[model samples]
Target: MVAREQFQVELSKLRGDIISLAHETEKLLEKSLEALYNQDIDMANDIISYDTKLDQKELKINEDAILLIARQQPVATDLRRLIIALRISSDLERMGDNAKNIAKSTIHLGEEHGLTIHPALTDMKNIALKMVDLSIKAFEYEDITLARKLSELDDLVDSMYGEIIREMLEETATNPQKIQHIMQMAFSARYIERFADHTTNIGESILYLVKGETLNLNE
Candidate 1:
């Protein structure tokens, strides 16, 4: 009984750690997007530098969770929960990496040509950020229904991405000299779209937590 209680305590801590990582990644992504919007070179640089913190947090969570598994030898649901926690941490870390890439693109798009961004990017970013928020909320509650909503949100982002690419390519044809800026904007959009996919993956993980069945919402 004592061992079981101790294992539960460790499992609770692991869950808390994973939630904290998601929140941290959310903040990083928000700041990076703001930096991109405002074209703040210093802020973009800071976002790039801050990625190491997310990396370290992910590593610590995995290490602690693995130690618990080794000591407790958890089976069935307990083991699955710990395993899902590890997957969530990995998705969150990759989300952080995507944010870092967006920040880099923001830096690359320094105010050289008096750039005016596409309206589609605004729509795309909004949906992507919403996915991040909703996915984390779903995970916290283990709400399978809420997790399923992510697929629709992911679809919205994907649609906007296609529109952005089409518009940018057309604009590039006219302003051939600004091809480099166009590429950076396109890459930034791709990064955000990719992050949204990762967020959906998190929602899928949370759904697995609730239903004990894995569903690939990405498809």
Candidate 2:
């Protein structure tokens, strides 16, 4: 059963690729949050370095999917999984870009003005980070229940984003000098919100992978 052995080998490689990308995503989020918290330019700059690795991994994931399809002609569920791996890796790469964007914005804000960090946004960051972590676990375990739950949890981050935006607008309206700094803060919050959305997308992808039914986190 040489064919069977070959299939197993490829499957193992695919799983390895998925796990590596997941770990990379976690590191990206951690660095982004640490940069923001410390207002460290060097840490912000490091995102660009790590982004190269992410790009490479994305390319490998796509190439591997194509090879798997061409060689195996995987049917039904197997085909769906290969497709999901390709699709979800792209989403994960975009999430990493958003994390980079947040770090860049933090650097600019720190350089432009001595802006005081808002403690409340910490809640939103924590929520987004947790979402990413749980989404990975959901994928690794093929947990449909966790995928469904993640869909509902996104609203918590969304609500906090809205409230933070309102507070910033009110403050900026009263003090024109705060406009630029507040805008940077708003962008950072938006990045975190978008990050949460990507994580939810991963959750949805995992659900689809397991159940073959589309699950939208937006609902």
Among the numbered candidates, top TM-score falls to 1
Tens-place lDDT digits, model 1, residues 142-169: 7888889999999888888998899999
Model 2, 1-219: lDDT tens digits are: 356688768866886787678778777877887788788888888886788789889998899888989998998777888888888888889888888888888788775476766776778888887887788788777788887777777999888889999989997988798788889888888988898898889888888888888878865
Model 2 accuracy (lDDT, Cα): 0.82
- TM-scores of the models, in the order given: 0.94, 0.93
Clashes of 1: 0
As a whole number from 0 to 100, the lDDT of residue 189 in candidate 2 is: 87
The local distance difference test score of model 1 is 0.86
Clashing residue pairs in all predictions, respectively, total 0, 0
> Which residue pairs show collisions in model 1?
none
Where in model 2 is the C-alpha error above 4 Å?
Answer: 1-3
